[model samples]
Target: MAFLELHGLTKTFGGVPAVDELNISVETGEFLSLLGPSGCGKTTTLNMIAGFLDPSAGNIRLNNAPLHTVKPRDRGLGVVFQSYALFPHMTVSENISFGLEILKVPQGEARRRVEDVIDLVRLAGMAHRFPAQLSGGQQQRVALARALVIEPPLLLLDEPLSNLDAKLRDDMQSELRRIQRSVGTTTIMVTHDQSEAMALSDRIAVMNQGRLEQAGSPQEVYDKPASAFVSGFLGKTNLLHGRLQRGGDGIGVIDIAAHRFRASDDQTCSPGPVKLSLRPEHIRIGKDAEDHACRVSGQIHSRVFLGDRWIYDVNCVLGTLLVYGQSGAAPFEDAETVSMSWDAAKLRIVEAGHA
Candidate 1:
């Protein structure tokens, strides 16, 4: 059995579903991220799992036992909210040891655990300081340490790093991953940031409009998105309307405007009107047409330099397509004609509309 399981888990408010029939299985010691935009039910799913909200219909199981029946405080799950939620009057040590105090752990053992977690989060010297005295990063560490001090079976983080600045958030992402790895804890984090989810999760379950759109590794979801919502949400991509014609050799040809592009026949779609998702980075600009399986001629409509890469909007025979060029490579100027090419395997047929 999976370490944690949610079968048809659901929630509703005012007769409208906030989370609908969501199912997920999490292995022991694995990190799974619930990722989506705001109001996409990611937070609601996390809340249901954390026992902060009751499920309208469904079962939550932990260790093959029913977990939904348990009260919030008795679930023994560590949760760090978006807000640190530390008691302003309590010192770091006091905050971390509070759970142990409630559990009636021996004073010596509680003190030792508190000290160990404090060191684990690298806040050894700041144990005596209150939340008001700590910086945003330090306070975040305190919240994380407090949650870890209990050593619960599951750790839940709801946008835990959202409050930190960009640099701090990056630093804390590394720190959080390291801490989770060292402890080998089963963790579920909820976040709206795609980059954050990609950087931190072993698997990502993307939600849209109270339903699960797709669940897979970062690369799997990015390369082969299940729907138009996922293809557009996970990263920058050009979604072009086309007509598909399946070939006999497990390959398909997509006709976009006046151009015909070859794509893999992996997706289950009729040979009719379809949507093709092509990542900007996959479309090579200024490449030799003789070296590629598919090629198109286009003129650069506009270009934007974003430090490490250049984004170009090219007006091709098909339409305006976005392409990415590495900063180290020569960039094309506006109105410059170039040959754009991509592998047939990189083009994907995605279902239209959101889930």
Candidate 2:
């Protein structure tokens, strides 16, 4: 059995479900993320696991022990919040030792564990500083250290770095991964940020309106999204609502307005009206593409530079499409007609939802 298991985990408010029949598993020492937009039940799921909220219907098991009846303090779980939630008057060491103090651990043992986690979180020199004296990232580390000092079997973080600036958040993402790897504690985090989830999680469970849409590795979810919502949510994709039909040479052709684009026979759905998802990064403009690639024409409606890459909004018969290319590459001028190409394997069959 998985180290952490949520079976039929659900919650309701005013007779309406906030989390509905959600199921996921986290392996021993693995890092799992619940990722989705606001009010999508990610936080609620975390709260249920943390013992703050009761499930309307479902069971949460930690190492095969029922968690619903266990009090939050007795569950042997560590939690960090977006707010940091540090005691302003307490020094970093004191803050981390508070949990141990509550559990009546020996004073010497508490001090030893406090020093260990402080070093683990790279807050060695800031042990005596109060929360108010530390930077945002440092304060976050204190919160994490406090959670870890107890040596909990499971760690839960809820948007823990959301309060930091963009650069610090990025830096802390790396640090957080390092901390988790060093401890080898099973962890589950809840975040709405896609890149953060992709960077830190061993597996990501994408939620929508209280349901699990897809759960897989970062590469698997991004490259092989199972539904229309998953395709659109994970990253930038030029979703095309079109029809499909059997075509020549064992390939399936997708009919989009005046075009018939080739698709992988292995991914073709029922032969009729279907939707196609083409990532912006996959579409190439001009002749700078491999030979025999599917070539299509589009008018550059708009373009923007984003340091590392250029996003071009192209208008074609199918619809408006976005293409991502390297910043060093020459860009097509606005309203200029350009040729675009992508390999047939890049075309994906997705849900036939609204365009």
Candidate 3:
């Protein structure tokens, strides 16, 4: 059974529908991310799940129990917002103990819970410090501890690490994953950062304009994107437009600027226009390029050094295709002739619409 479920969920603000008929099932102990761009309704969906915003339609269930009528505080949800939402006047211990105090739990019990969570979040030595005194990453950890100390059934993180610097954000991602695994809390995070979602989630629901575009494991979502939007949004992609043709060898072929390239057959296609999705890293550049696979020759228009890899823009028969080569490999210079090819198996057949 799913740990959390949303059936036909809808939310509207004035005339704009922020979330529409969004149906999703999150497995118990799974870390799921609502991944999308700004205005894509990821946060709106999180809000609905947290009971902060009532849905315009449909029901939310936890382990098959209805949650639509539950108050936000009584819904057994722990939320960590992007802003941290720590109380400025309270010390770290007080902030972490606030929820227990609101429930009128005994002071000793609240202190014990606070101490346990502070240790769990690795903030044992900083209990007496105020939020103003803690670093951004530390403050985030405190906010996380504050939520977890209550031992809620679900945890909702709304871009929780967005406030941190780049290096700190990277550290916090790994830290968050470790803490989540240790506690095994059913988690749902909302974030626009594709890398963050890919790194942390067991599965991701890609959303756009109020609808769910696709939901799958990170590799499944990245390697076999269901739509053009997912292909471009999750990571770098080379989208080549072409028409399908059946080769005499019982294989499928795509015609790109008069060049016929072999590709794996998709039986559903009926010899029509289709788009091919290729990841930048999938395209290989070699001196002795073989023509047995899908091959195209192009001139290196530009080369960019991106830390551990080199991104090359090649002007080929299929238009400008971006190829990512490892940093220390044979460097291809600008305006140099190059052969770009990838295993036909790597190409993904996609329809035209972002649908």
lDDT of 1 by residue, 1-355 (tens): 9999999999999999999999999999999999999999999998888888999999999999999999999999999999989999999999999999999999999999999999999997898898999999999999999899999999999999999999999999999999999999999999999999999999999999999999999999999999889999999999888888766776778878867777675656777888778999998888455576688888999999999999999998878999999999888888998999888878888863311
Segments in model 3 whose C-alpha atoms lie over 4 Å from true places: 265-268, 352-355
List where candidate 1 sits over 4 angstroms from the true fold: 248-250, 287-290, 352-355
Better of 1 and 2 by lDDT: 1
TM-score ranking, high to low: 1, 3, 2
- What TM-score would every model get versus the actual structure? 0.96, 0.96, 0.96
C-alpha RMSD for every candidate: 1.8, 1.7, 1.7
- The lDDT of each candidate is 0.91, 0.88, 0.89
> Where is the poorest 10-residue window by lDDT in model 2?
286-295
TM-score winner between 1 and 2, please give it: 1
Candidate number with greatest lDDT: 1
